[model samples]
Target: MAEKLTDSEGREDLVYIKTEDGSYRGWRVDLLIDNLSSKMEEKILLCSSCKGMLRDACFYEGDLKCGVCIPEGVAWQPVKMNREIVSDKMISCPVKKRGCEWSDTVSTVMHHLEKCEFFPVLCPLGCVCLDGERKGKVMKLERKLIPKHQRDSCPLRELVCEFCMNTVKGCEMNPHLEICEHFPLLCPNRCVIEGEEGTRQVKRRDVSVHLANECPLQKVECPYWIYGCREEMERKEMNLHEREFLHIHHRLSITDMKQKQIQMSKDNKLLEEKLDTATERIVLVEKNFESKSRELLTFKQNQIETSKQTIDKLEIATKKIAFLQNENESKIKELSKVKHMEDKLDTANIKIENLEKQISKKDSELKSIIEVLYSHISLATGQLEWKIKGVKQKIENKESSYGDPFYVGLYKCQGNIEWNYDNTGKVVVAICIVKGAYDDKLHWPIIYKYTFILLCHINSYYNYEITKQVTKEDLEKYPNSLKRPTEMRNDGLGTRSLISNTEILEAKYCKEDSITLLIKIELLPAL
Candidate 1:
């Protein structure tokens, strides 16, 4: 079908045919179809009666046959729908086998293939041979392979020379490197020159300058060559030569020093001649000074009498100065005393400031402690459990003990189990109120109620409880006892005979040698 389709010229060569051998020939399918459509109105129209080509189509049968072949038709009417139907037919891309998956209507298929990346394209480098049999020929490559070929294989591709970093054509890189001045070459002497601290490689151009001037392996005259030591050796060996022939070098140095001394002796002789000339001039100056001294002695005799009068006036002024010095010393001593007092005042001020700072620090600490105590009291719930371990052992040993302090409302209180107190010979359990941070803020003469429970391990019903309610009358009777603590603590208020030593040992109140005490306090509104 593709082979049958022709272009406007009626040539079948426009459409490419895919053969059994998998070879494609001639123009693509879309290109051939587009060409035929442009000329189809004139070339494809046929006369229905004559079955011949029709240049003019006045009447149309499915837009394929024209009425021009019949006698009356002189104008042409185009086959519009026929071209649209042909152009709308969907077709696959010719290069779909090369990974192009595009399939579109015949009208736009050629436009899609024009921009497709999978389609084969010539080398972008447009490389052309300048010499040899292939001269003037441009290289061709697939679009996908163009980049790799231009980068690595294209002869006309621009590449940088590794030695000089100069850009050149890829084909000319070898020739450029051959003539490059910066290209590295081995030293002719093959001397083992030390490289930079970290790298073993050194620039060859720098090494060439080093070889000409400073290379230790290069031959050099001895440093003492001008001093009559004529030895030519490598610079590295010159130091060894000097050491091996030290006596000869020392003799040469002595000779050089002797020559210097001779020159210095001549200089000293010339200096001595100049000094003799100066001494002659000084003799004449001394004679002239002797005459001047005689005249000065006469003037001094005259000045002595004038000086005697001046001295008398100076002695009187000295007496006045001595008196003023004595007086100034006394005032200075007074000023020193005042300065000492001022120093003492400054020291006192410093001490006062330090004391103020210390007081401020103490106040901050007290405030923090009060806040902690208030927080504890606020969260208290007025309930506590005191467990006394080894109660039986304490009774047997006669040991008196107190528990750790705790907060009940605003009170710092403790529970104590005393074996004997004031020779009572009875076990006493008491609750004591200690001085607390919140004491000043609390109401004096405590009005809250207190409940104490002594738990029985054997039976819950056998537990003993005590309730203490302080009324207005009782507060007046025991004013000091109920008042907020002013000292370390107020005296303990619980029963003195809570349990006898013999009875407390029983299992009813004690289990596992321990007893539990539960205390709950009720807060009252401030009056």
Candidate 2:
């Protein structure tokens, strides 16, 4: 029968029955119950009477049967059943006996056993001990047990002195430290105090007690107990008094005296050497000065001779300079004359240039006049040729029956000219035609008769008469009247009167028949 139980901590409890002893052990319930049940089925045989479901069965607890079915006075005994052993596997508890009944699982049982406290832990150094403290004790015992031959090979066999604590060979520490002062000595005074002040005037035997309480010779850092005292003091009265009353200046004065003595000795030695050197230098300088003075005298004599020669040469140079000066004065006078001549020549050249300009201007004027005359002659010749040709053609055209007149008359009359000045300083010429007789017959007799008749007829027709307005004095003053016929026409003369007036010159009429008329005009220079 499976029993359901709980532990004190309220966890499910399991019971395992040992096959050999039939003893039970409790564990925390796990899933191994299913395996246990399956193993029990494989081990237990089924009964044939009830087909594995018998109601009353005989099972042994010890070796006795059930009390109910047995005779009276029979005792019930507990039996040890082989629990139907599944596998004889010895598994250790996983909890290492720390109040747990859990056995190690098959997969982790070896590892759990290795770390288990129930499994003895050995030293890593191979000592037969469980921990470091026991290992150390074991090593100490091993060292003690070693024989002298082994002990010589053991590093820990060497002994160290108690006082100096230096390692030495076995049994040699006492002799080695015999000279060491730190060897144990019984001192009535412990002398625990440190420093020089604690040792002064104190007896060696009582040093420790005195230093603990009353020793006054110790060296101490200053507590600055006095108002301005900052110096450290020795604990002894003598040292403190000495420090308070030491004569510092006396020592300094002694040192100063020694230094001054040394300096004076050096100065005296230097002065003596300088005196000897100065005396030698003075003697040398005096000799050098005497020699230099003699040389200077010789040089001065030479300089005097050279100066006399220079003075004579300077006199000769002075005479030559005076002569040159006289020559230079004469040359300067000649140069002044040449300069004056040059000035006069410049003035003369200016005058000559003006005269040349005037001559050039006159020549230009003459050329202009000649050119005018040539132009007039050419024009006159051309006109004369044209008039002659015309006259010859007219004569040739006349028939024999029609008698051609053998004589032809041409006349030119010049009036007397007058001059007048305008405001611009230009001269003006005026000429007037005059009435005159020509040839034996009255010149222009027909034109004169026509002029008179026409004038009378013009007076009758217009009831006004034409009269000669220009006087003879006016005609004489402007005698060259024929030269400008327009001026005569402006006198209000009839055309027949103009014709009769033009015939007044006999020479002009004769030349008209014999020679062709040539009118030549030119501009003449202004008067």
Candidate 3:
């Protein structure tokens, strides 16, 4: 369907008819017209008959196709047209004046304005000049201004004076001159001398008057000034017409000597006071020495008395040892008897054991014979009775053989000879003396022999069997044992256990130069 209309001004309007078969035949009254003033290029209308591209065509049907493209023989109808305005300004570029042919919509034109090269650039110092020449000059002026401003504003600038080596600023020079030490001033006196005519300022106010009397250029009225009277003169020349002349320096020397004598008298009084103080200190030192000497003498007397008491105790101990030695001798004799009895008992026990073994062998043989003969007899009873009798006799023989009569007798006498003379004390000293004599002898064998004797005696007295054997290899492994006896004795004496039996046995001792009584005990093992 298509539609057509006319503007209010009534321009030419056309309405093409479209059939119900969807084809345009020709202009018909059924077509609706809309906006007849609108341009043909801006409006589209479909051909009812051919449905092809149409020019000079208005609304032909209700459809939006071209009028020429529609086919014929379709039923026709018309619809009112709706038109929309299109603006020319929407498709043109804003920079078209600068030869930019590009076109865009209004929204796209605003985005291009941000990055456009035609936008103005400003200087960093807030200057408006974008020209290169003026920008460089402005930057140079900023750099020069910074340092000049800093120097003028800094507070610690140095100031110095050109003369007199004193520091004065431009404002402080006036006050310094009034009190200046190096300032020159004219002399007040009108008197003139030979070489100091115009400038003879007095250095001391008190001595200025003396300079008038001692002026060297003063004229003398006698020959002392003209004919060389031979006087060292420094005095006012009086007009006296005389021949005598005297030296001025002689009088000044006499006055100076008298002042020095007055100063010496005051110094002498201070020296006398210092001498008295030194004498008092010397007297105090003497008194201190006397007190210290008396205290030293008392300390020495106490040390002597302590030494005497120690000597008396040592003497008493020596006498007690002598008594013990006498008692030890008697016990040694009894030990020899006990050793003899032990040997005899050991032999008897061996013989008795052999006899019991023989008796057991004979009993076994007899029982075997009886068993062979009693195969048919009721021999169990008779055999039991014989066996019982043999068992009883064997038990009686075992009791008799095992009985230790000698041991019982020895045990009874054991208490009486309990203090056996352990010649260990003497033996250890003798072995050490022998080792010292030979010098090269390894004394391990002597030590092992003594240990064996001690262990054997202990085992014998206690009736205990020693199962472990001490070998020569064991003695060699511990070779330091050779000197252990002497070390033990010294340690014992130092601990005040010199009379102990075990300590005496353990000590290693030596004789000194054929003197057996002066024994030397070694306190360390020989390496």
Best by TM-score: 1
Which one wins on lDDT? 1
lDDT of 1: 0.68
Off by over 4 Å in 1: 1-106, 110-141, 150-185, 193-201, 204-216, 243-248, 267-527
**Per-residue error at 401 for model 1, in Å?**
99
Q: Which sequence of candidate numbers ranks them by lDDT, best first? A: 1, 2, 3
lDDT of 1 by residue, 340-433 (tens): 9999999999999999999999998987887776655643436678888987677767786777787777767776667855666687766667
Off by over 4 Å in 2: 1-248, 341-527
Task: Give lDDT: candidate 1, residue 392.
Answer: 64
**For residues 1-527, what per-residue lDDT tens digits would candidate 2 score against the true structure?**
33333333345433221122332222222323234345344223222222221112234443223223334545544222322231232344533333434464433444554454433322223333235434343232221233543345333347767766777765455566665545544333323345533323433345456554454544454433232334554455545554654555345456767888999999999999999999999999999999999999999999999999999999999999999999999999899989999999999999999999999999889767755654443222110111222222332343111111111122222211111222222211111123322222222211111101111111335221222323345445543432333332222122222212123222332234321222222222212
The better candidate by TM-score, 1 or 3, is 1
TM-score of 3: 0.16
Estimated TM-score per prediction? 0.29, 0.20, 0.16
Predicted candidate 3 versus true structure: per-residue lDDT over 292-350, tens digit per residue: 99999999999999999999999999999999999999999999999999999999999
Q: For each candidate in the order shown, give its overall lDDT on alpha carbons.
A: 0.68, 0.39, 0.38
The number of residue pairs in model 3 that clash at the backbone is 42
Residue pairs in clash, model 1:
57-76, 57-77
